[model samples]
Target: MNKNFIIKKNREGKKEDVPKKIFFKTNLFYKEKGFLKFFIYSPIVKEYAFYTLFPNGLNLFIYDKNTYNKYTYLRADWVKSIDKMFFHIKGNIIIMSHKGVSLKTEEIFWDRRKKKIFNKKYTKIIFHSKKMILYAINGIEASEDLKKIRLKNINGTFPVK
Candidate 1:
């Protein structure tokens, strides 16, 4: 079986196509015992990054390792639905970083962890869901307004990977 896989996500209530560049650019790095690692290229950033996927019991984790950052997700109670060409992890996803912070989201795609740099310093934003009221962020000082969902913009440098 081919090691490559395709992940599709819903955006703005519509199915968005996964960029074709992702298929050609993601090179298999390693595979062992139901685990695989690949280097996925992001056209948005015009760079290559690492992705690792491994399954443990009922949970599957996909780790994204960038030049200067590491992010991971823990998907629990995922009921698999296999089609002719693709499989899906149907459940909630917990997005985590090397820094140990995490946010949980339902039906999210590719753990939306982003890093920004300015003046030699960097910040991170772990955006999981548009409806922030449905999920929670654990770690850092987050705001609490039942009427307003809180997201954190943390100031910290990503550890060298």
Candidate 2:
């Protein structure tokens, strides 16, 4: 797996090996067998990413990044209809989806492990090629493609200074 496709926490502040550009989104979240599973959709790159976050580690599976467009066109159902898209990041050959999903590397190494639903506060989130960040507090999903630009409420894009 490519390190650039992962963002993990270590002894240091944080380790995010991402590409120069990114597009990401996460619609469904659940826990299973000591791993957090995420179903993500990327409108820009038109790719679907499945993430499995283990205690202190991250695993990502992108469904045909190079040739997803063709597949999506053939199988529209592959891109599940999302009522609420938390966040999907993709760019520079990497994509990430976060739906109230947050965890530290040390948390994965806990002696006692448990499974629970995600409890983040935010709603809609979408990243565009490290150029813009989009999110909503009231929890809203996009009905159409969004443009990358600075917004008043949404935080700036990733790789911030």
Clash number for each model: 0, 16
User: 55-116, model 2: which lDDT tens digit per residue?
Assistant: 11123332223332221111111222122232222111112322221111111111112211
The runs of at least 3 residues in candidate 2 whose Cα sits more than 4 Å from the true structure, single-residue gaps closed, are 1-53, 65-120, 123-130, 140-161
lDDT of 2 at 85: 38
TM-score of candidate 2 relative to the true fold: 0.21
TM-score of each: 0.26, 0.21
**RMSD to the hidden true structure, all candidates:** 15.5, 16.9
User: Scored by Cα lDDT, where does model 2 land?
Assistant: 0.28
Error in Å for residue 27 of model 1: 21
> What lDDT would candidate 1 get against the real structure?
0.31
* Superposed model 1: Cα runs more than 4 Å off: 1-57, 63-71, 79-88, 110-161
Which ten residues in a row are the worst by lDDT in model 2? 103-112
